[model samples]
Target: EPEVTQTPSHQVTQMGQEVILRCVPISNHLYFYWYRQILGQKVEFLVSFYNNEISEKSEIFDDQFSVERPDGSNFTLKIRSTKLEDSAMYFCASSYRMGGELFFGEGSRLTVL
Candidate 1:
């Protein structure tokens, strides 16, 4: 079965640097999203994109973050400047139908010093 793939399962960086989390969502799926889980917090949605525009976004998605589909199969999340609190597991997900069950990649663990 086709599955989503995330790069660099673990990442470590200083308090104010850029980081790019990558993913390859299942083919044939359209909707894509990015979410994060603080060390002991619940997974929270950052943003959802479809047809090249943002469909939904949580309060957490601010100026420091951006998402892109640079190619047909790759989706990426870029953090312009990371902070200590930005240390978390970033997950990429995609679904064929809106509001349907979302399939998530294993996740990329980002640790900002």
Candidate 2:
């Protein structure tokens, strides 16, 4: 089965630094999503993209954050200015159906120091 892939399985960055988390979603999937978990907290939706535009986004996707499909297969989330609160396990997910059965990547762990 095709799977979503993320880079820098673990990342440690200073509180004010910029970071870009990368993911390559399944080639045949039509919807892509980003979700994050803060240690023990519930997973939160960050954004969803389809047809080359953002379909939905949560409040957590603030002005300091941006997402893009840099290429046909690569999707990325850029945090221009990171905060301690930004430390979380960022997961990239994809689904063929839209009712929300998301298949997630192993996740990129971001640690803000």
Candidate 3:
């Protein structure tokens, strides 16, 4: 079965540095989302995208965060500037429709120092 895939399985960066996480959702899925878990915290929703436009975003998804579907097969999340508090396991997920079952990637771990 098809599943979400993320690149740079783990990344270590200095504070204030830029970081980009990439993902490829299930081929036929329609909705895409970026979610993060800060260590032991609950999974926090960052943003959702569909039809190449942002559908919704959380307050945690400040100006520093951005999501894009640069091509038909690729979805990405970029952090303009990394902060110590931004360290977490970023998960890329997708579903056939909003609020449907989500297929999640193994996750890209980001560590800000």
TM, every model: 0.96, 0.94, 0.96
Q: Tens-digit lDDT track for model 3 on 29-97? A: 999999999998999999999999999999999999999999889999999999999999999999988
> Each candidate's lDDT (Cα)?
0.94, 0.92, 0.95
Ten-residue region with minimum lDDT total, candidate 1 = 51-60
**Total clashing residue pairs per candidate?**
0, 0, 0
Candidate 2 residue pairs in backbone clash: none
- For model 2, residues 1-113, the per-residue Cα lDDT tens digits are 78889998999999999999999988888799999999999999999999889999999998988989988889899999999999999999988768857889999999999
What does the lDDT read for residue 29 in candidate 1? 91
Q: Which stretches of candidate 2 lie over 4 Å from their true place?
A: none
Q: Best-fitting candidate, measured by lDDT? A: 3
lDDT of model 1, residue 35:
95
What TM-score number comes out for model 3?
0.96
lDDT per residue for candidate 1 within 28-56, as digits (tens), equals 89999999999999999999999977888
User: What TM-score does prediction 2 earn?
Assistant: 0.94
